[model samples]
Every structure is written in structure tokens, then in C-alpha cells.
Target: MRRIGLCISLLVTVFVMSACESEDEAQTFADRDQETVKHTTVKPMSNKNKQDFQTLPNDMQLAIVFSSMIRVSEAFDYGIGNPEYFVRSSMTEGEADIAKENLESIQFENKQLKKQNNEAVALLQKTHNQEMSHNEMQQLKENRTAFFEVTESMIKLISQVTPKNAKKTRQQLDQLKKQYTQYSAESVKIMNSIVKKQGADKASFERHLETMLQKQPGQPMLSELY
Candidate 1:
């Protein structure tokens, strides 16, 4: 009877150990599955963030290049007269320092974009003349995309206002918004000039530009203005 009792006790211990092992294995597999799902979700999101510059139509690319050029030119012009407004400010000292660093980066990028604007204009002229190569046009599109991306980043930064500087920031942004309206008008004139200069009747370019502008995230749509 004692031997029988010991045998039963051993059997129960073995069963418990086996159950524990099975549960541990199941948990390990569950952790691995979660990791795999996380990786799968993250990879596609990273890829989705990348802009497919090559997929854009050539006409649309030209309009983007023109739009970027107009914005860059307007920013430069506005900075010349309102140099104080170009300086970024923040509430805390740490944030103020960061703002300074961002402003410096923005200034550098804007200068570079300004330099490229002449090249962009030359490319537009080449495009109008039907002399631009596929490679050259593609390069223009990529450059303009980069230009707009930088400008968009700067604009977003400026649009944000802390409680300390809300009024000042709004005042600055208001001035910039007026300038943006001027930019749209100037873009229209520039596009008309380009078409007239090329003796081309493809008003489709204007339509394309309008569509692209309407898709911009924050700014008021040109269509709404009319």
C-alpha cells in the first residue's frame, strides 16, 4: 500500500511537469508570432512612407517643379523684407535652442533650393521647347519633390504655436498666408507666360497644377479661392 501511494505521487509530479513544459512552449510560440506580426506591420508602413517619384506623370512632374520654384522664390522674397519673422522662437530655453537649430537648417535648405530654382526655370524652358531628355525631366521632378518636402517641413514647424508665443506666431503666419495667396497668383501668371512663350495651347498644364495644389495637405485650395 505504501509503494502504491509513492507510485501515484510520482505519476502526478511527472504529469504536472509535462503540463508546465507544454504551456511554456505554447507561450514561446505566442511571443514569436507577435514579433512576426509586428515586423510585418512595420515593414509595409516604412515602405509606404516612401514617395514613388517615378510613378508621377511627366506633366504633373513639371507642374510640381513649377510650384516648388514659385514657393521657393516667394519665400526668398519674403525673407528679404521680413528678416525678423524668419527667426524661429519657442517658450522654453531648450525648445528655443532646438528652434534655432531648426531655423539654421531651414535657412541652409532654402538657400540651396533658391540656387536650384534657376536650374528649375531653365528645365521648364527646356521642357517647353521639347528639348528636355527623359533623364533630365526625371531629375527635375526628384529635385522639386525634395524642395517641396523641405518647404512643407518648415511651414509645419512655423504653424505650430506654443502658449507663450501664440499671438506672435499667428501674426507671422498670417503674413505668410498672405504671401502664399500672392504665390498662387504669381504661379498662374508664370504658367501663362510659359505657355505663351512656348506658343502651346495645352491649358491642361494649368488644370494639372490646380489639381496638385488642391491635394496639398494644409494650405487652402486654389479651387476654393475662386
Candidate 2:
């Protein structure tokens, strides 16, 4: 009887130790799993959608091209002659080269028209007259008209480009379009104010333009410019 009792005590001690070791292992595994959950839960930043000029979505691509042309016109109107600003700010190096190549491919007639517009702006600046010559004024009107037309095109493009699976993209595009339209109207107000003051100083005008551009639909993409 004494021998049996001793054997029973030994067995109970071994069983208790084994049970404790199993509990410890399970707790360690739970802790490791909690760490893994924390690591996997962290989110990454969204990627930028690089514009491919060649393979542009038909409706969307034309909108971008026209928008770029309008920007070039605006730059000319405002005495911002450097294409580098548009090239560097609007696109990556690859896109810039693509755009430059495309622009170069235009026929002589279209190139002449672009040059004529530039000359018209220069003539107006030299004369310092709001009342420009017939040809110069006509070019100015064309530039402004193109800018407005492209703005409409861009709104349409945004509508088409919003992904079917992405409610957020649709919502974002809608809000962007509304803000851009409002700011487009306000740009005229600011331009008028500048004209009233006979055009603000370069620094002042730039600041105003920056503020205005910031309000536009696609300006967030310009963050990559910096």
C-alpha cells in the first residue's frame, strides 16, 4: 500500500508539470500571433497613377493633352515663357520627353499657330495695352477659349475615369470637379483684380497663381513635382 501511494504522488507531479508546459507553449504562441496581427494590420501608402501618353484611355487621354495645351497657353499669356516649368511640374521626366516629342510631331501649320500666339502675347506686353492689335487680340481670345474648352473636357474625363469598383474614386472625382469649377470662375476674379492693379508684382502674381492652382482638381498630383 505504501509503495502504491508513493507511485501515485510521483505520477501526479509529472502530469502537473506536463500540463503547465503545454499552457506556457500556448501562451507563447498567442503572444507571437498578436505580434503578427499588429504587423500585418499596418497599411501602405497609395501608388501614383503614372499617365501613359501612348496608351491613354481614349476619352481621358484627350482631356489630358488638351489640358496641357491650355496650360501652355496660360503660361504664354502670363509671360511664363519657359516650357521647363510646365514640363517639370506637370510630368515626370519620361512623360515630359513623351510630351515634347508629341508636340514636335505636330505639322508646321500648327507649330506656326503656336508661335503666332506667343508673338501676340509678346506684342501685347510691349505695347502694355489691354487693347491689342486685331491679330494679337484674336490669338488671346483663342487661348482663353481653349482653356475653357479643356476645363470642360477634363470634367468629362474625370467622370469617365472613375473606376467602377471604386466608390471612393467616384466621390473624389466629383468633389474635385466641383472645386475646380468654382476655382475656375474665381481665377477670372483674381485675374481681373490683377489687371485692375496693372498686374501684380511677379512674386505676388505667382503666389496668387499657386493658391488658385492648389484649388484645382488635379493639383494634388503636382505634389510629385516637389
Every model's TM-score: 0.34, 0.23
Q: Compute the lDDT of residue 186 as modeled in candidate 1.
A: 33
Best by TM-score: 1
lDDT tens digits, residue span 94-127, model 1: 5444434434433544545555465455545445
Best by lDDT: 1
Error of 2 at 208 (Å): 26
Candidate 2: pairs in clash: none
Candidate 2 lDDT by residue in tens digits, 1-226: 0000011122222222322222222111111111111111111113564433334322232222223333333322221111111222223445444423322212212333354334333423332333423443444455445544543343333223312323443454344434433333333333333233333243443333334333332232111110
